[model samples]
Target: MAYTFEILETEKIELVIPLVYKLNNGKIDKAVLMERFSDMITYNNYECAVIYDGSKLIGVTGLWFCTRHYSGKSVEPDHVFIDENYRGKGLGKQFFEWIYNYVKDKGCEAVELNTYVSNAASHKFYFNEDFKILGFHFLKKLKK
Candidate 1:
């Protein structure tokens, strides 16, 4: 199977949104997706890449470039998603390798991403890809 990574554009937003919604397990609302798409278009310091099998969008991944006083410099993978049908076909690894190489070429010292503790499969994949677990991530939910 052949795969290609294309730089995401506003024209492909519709196709990308559904895959992202599926990856997030339907937790994200359409409104939020639209808002984020707008933000992605307006933000010049970030990069978004989508994987395609022929003409169909199958995966999406990206990172925001930023520098912090305490953390120094780093790039964070905002969202990484592979379509259910494409999972386990070695596409996820390709996505991460591409992201790592892209970030390294852009002079980022490190890349970071967060996944829920319950996602054991993801944990194994990340570990196999050589991503070290630094520590725990604590979250505080705000009542709406």
Candidate 2:
């Protein structure tokens, strides 16, 4: 199947909120997702990549660019998801191949990301893509 991809600009990020909702399986309200995406866009360090088959959204992923002391400039792919209708079709691999080239063209020396420990499927996918475990991704949420 033919597909199109774009790393959406801040002004067009609303296109991604719905897909993010799907990624979260509706655990978070769409309104709250929109709000969080708005905040992230405001930072100007994040953008989202999406795959579309004509008018239908097939997948979405978040790309965070930053200068890490350890990795220098890097692109972190977050919340990667391909629609259930399209999974196991090599779309995930192609999507990440596109992302890898995109970030490398932009001078990213490394790529880093966090995935839930429970997401064994993603861990397998990432490993197949040659991503190695560097260390634990620790986190502490703040009171809001």
Best by lDDT: 2
The superposed Cα distance between candidate 2 and the true structure at residue 29, in angstroms, equals 1.2
lDDT (Cα, tens digit) per residue for candidate 2, span 1-144:
988878877787788877778877799998898899889878777888999989887788889999999889999998788888888988899898899999999999999988889889899999999899999988899999
User: 7, model 2: CA deviation in Å?
Assistant: 1.2
Per candidate, the number of residue pairs that clash is 0, 0
Angstrom error at residue 111, model 2: 0.9
Model 1, range 88-137, lDDT digits (tens) per residue? Answer: 88888988888778778888887777877777888899899888987788
Pairs of colliding residues, candidate 1: none
Q: TM-score winner among the candidates?
A: 2
lDDT score at residue 102, model 1, on the 0-100 scale: 78
